[model samples]
Target chain A: MTLLHTIYLIAITAEAMSGAIMGMRRGMDLFGICMLGTVTALGGGTARDILLGHYPVGWIANPEYLSFTIGAAIVTAMIARHMHHLRQIFLLVDGLGLVAFTVIGCGVGLEMEAHPSIVVLAGVITGIFGGLLRDILCNQVPLVMQRELYATVALFTGVFYVGMLWLEVNSSLATLLALGSGFLFRVLAMTFGWKLPDFQGKEIRGLD
Target chain B: MTLLHTIYLIAITAEAMSGAIMGMRRGMDLFGICMLGTVTALGGGTARDILLGHYPVGWIANPEYLSFTIGAAIVTAMIARHMHHLRQIFLLVDGLGLVAFTVIGCGVGLEMEAHPSIVVLAGVITGIFGGLLRDILCNQVPLVMQRELYATVALFTGVFYVGMLWLEVNSSLATLLALGSGFLFRVLAMTFGWKLPDFQGKEIRGLD
Candidate 1:
């Protein structure tokens, strides 16, 4: 397989595992677990492809990814009895997944002739959207809003990668640096419980 | 304003109300409330635009909608104390909101020269995506997944609308019929506790 195809496979694997862990942690039934897993696996890449004007959708194109996600979900459900402190694993895998997705998203955006800001934004979206879907399914505020410097890290890495491309840097070196930056930032934040400044405005009311 | 634009504005208003209710019920802060309202109002249109390959994103294209969403959210938060039985109100407004969005989405898809099947899918997406976003923000399974008939109703109505257009029927009449059909089906389902069959294939271990 080509490098891009290999990356896609790894990306799908990460997505499937992330989804499975989320389902097991949530104590959801098999159906709900599979649903959550599928959503997590496809959410970010789906958004990316749609925004990039790709037809048939990525998951729809590669139905095997969907099947893999479902299989992961079922296995996780069976092992739910023994999964302890799995949140840490989910977070780690999730961060790596984000890094992988961001790199690919930025690379694809650049290849598609997108503007720099938009390319970076695309990377951020690819990095964060799956977790957003996971959080929503698990009935929590999206980590994108409440957590550590997740989006900032993704955005920064995207800028770095795009800048390297602009400067005619080695593609492999730029990709490795960008991915490492995001992954390291996320791991450190997880270890230290780093948080963004919370908005101090009066609490809003009347939302359902 | 063009009829299409007017319909879209009304749909946004309904969406804002839905978000405000979600936030007030969830006890989110002001920024959170505004975020919910914006997502509710713009999420469907944004998704449609993205899927149809439109650029700049509709909400990003016209920032006024964002301001309006925030303003509406603030006002709703203020008046929530006096609101009673907001659940029923949500059901009604959300149902209507779905119908309005379906029409607007199909119209845009038609304008884009999309195939009829794609147009129907667009309508269904617009009808449900905002609510899906709202539910996700609130940490709930999306209404569409939990209620299978939800998006299906919109899809059928969209197909009917597009079929009418294909037969050279009046555009306004076709739109109205489509909207009404979707709205009535949803309202009836909500009132009747309608749902699709549940997954009952016995939880097989590692059965992905």
Candidate 2:
């Protein structure tokens, strides 16, 4: 496998395990755990392909990818306590994975000769949709909507990647730019406890 | 417009309004109201089309459908209190809408010449995915997953539609069966507090 493929697997494994972890926190049954985990790992790519009308979504093309996420979920189930101890490492890895997802997402959009608007949209969707799926399953407001610098990082990464490609930059260099900037933005935000502006929830309880 | 088209518009409008109502309950901003409402109105069809690789998703095919849902959301924002008193009516309408979504979903799947399994999957997806979107946005375990008879009804509706087609029944009669049974199932379940068995959530807050 290429370096990119290796990173992609790393990202998917980290994401799926995190999703399984969320399922555990929510006291979800085994079925819920596996479902959410798989969704979390593959949801972004699925959304992107569907949005672009790209047939045979990524995991569908390589069903083995599905097995990887399932394995990650099972491993998480078995090593929850140990993983918790390594949470800091996972955070760094997740940040890296987000960057990887953005670069790959931009490539997919560009490959399709999508509109400039769609390129950026695809990148952001790919970067954040998985965590959105996880948060939805866990019954929380999507972290990307409120988390500092996350979606912004994805947007900026998309812009950078697309712009570089537009300027005839080679694929490797553009990916590196996208990857480095997104990773830095994410890690910096997480380190500094940064947050986005959020709507104040009123908990109205008014009937519809 | 065909009967299916008419019912679909009704379904989307009601689902969007309900989503807007949920946004109100959550004290979401106007943006949130519009976002969740649109998701609730279109999410099921989007999921169904995506899974089936149907191109130019429903809202994309006719942007007016999206506008209708947005309009319903805005209207709900203005008249949320008035609508609260009509909760019973809304509930009944929602039930009917579920039936409408199911038949349309099944038809789409059939048009694709999908596998027997895919036909039913499409039906359930079209029927309940929007509600799932709404509940997720509202930060609740999907009511469809836990509530009795909801997904089950959608499953049966799809099964009935696909089975009739498989048996070479006339299309109109098959649709009628799918719609009637799904509608009755939903209404009866709502009225009688029918529910699917669900895993108990312990609120663990474990090592996510």
> Which prediction has the highest lDDT against the true structure?
2
- Per-residue CA lDDT of candidate 2, range B46-110, in tens? 98987887986787556678678889988887777667677887777777788888888888888
Across A1-208, the per-residue lDDT of candidate 2 in tens digits comes to 2666788899999999999999988888888888889999899998888877877799989999989999999888888877888899888888888888888887787787766756776787798889887887676877664446777777778888899889999888878877888788888888898664333335333443
Model 2 clashing residue pairs (backbone)? B148-B195, B148-B196
Model 2 chain B — which ten-residue stretch has the worst lDDT?
B26-35
* Residue A86 displacement (Å), model 2: 2.0
lDDT of 1 at A87: 62
Relative to the unseen true structure, what is the C-alpha lDDT of residue A185 in candidate 2, on a scale of 0 to 100?
Answer: 84
Query: For model 1, how does the per-residue alpha-carbon lDDT over A1-208 read when each residue is reduced to its tens digit?
Result: 1554565566566566667767777677788888887888778877776766656777788788887778877877777567555666666766777777888888767766766766776787777777777887677787575546777677778888889988999998888887788789889877887765443223433323
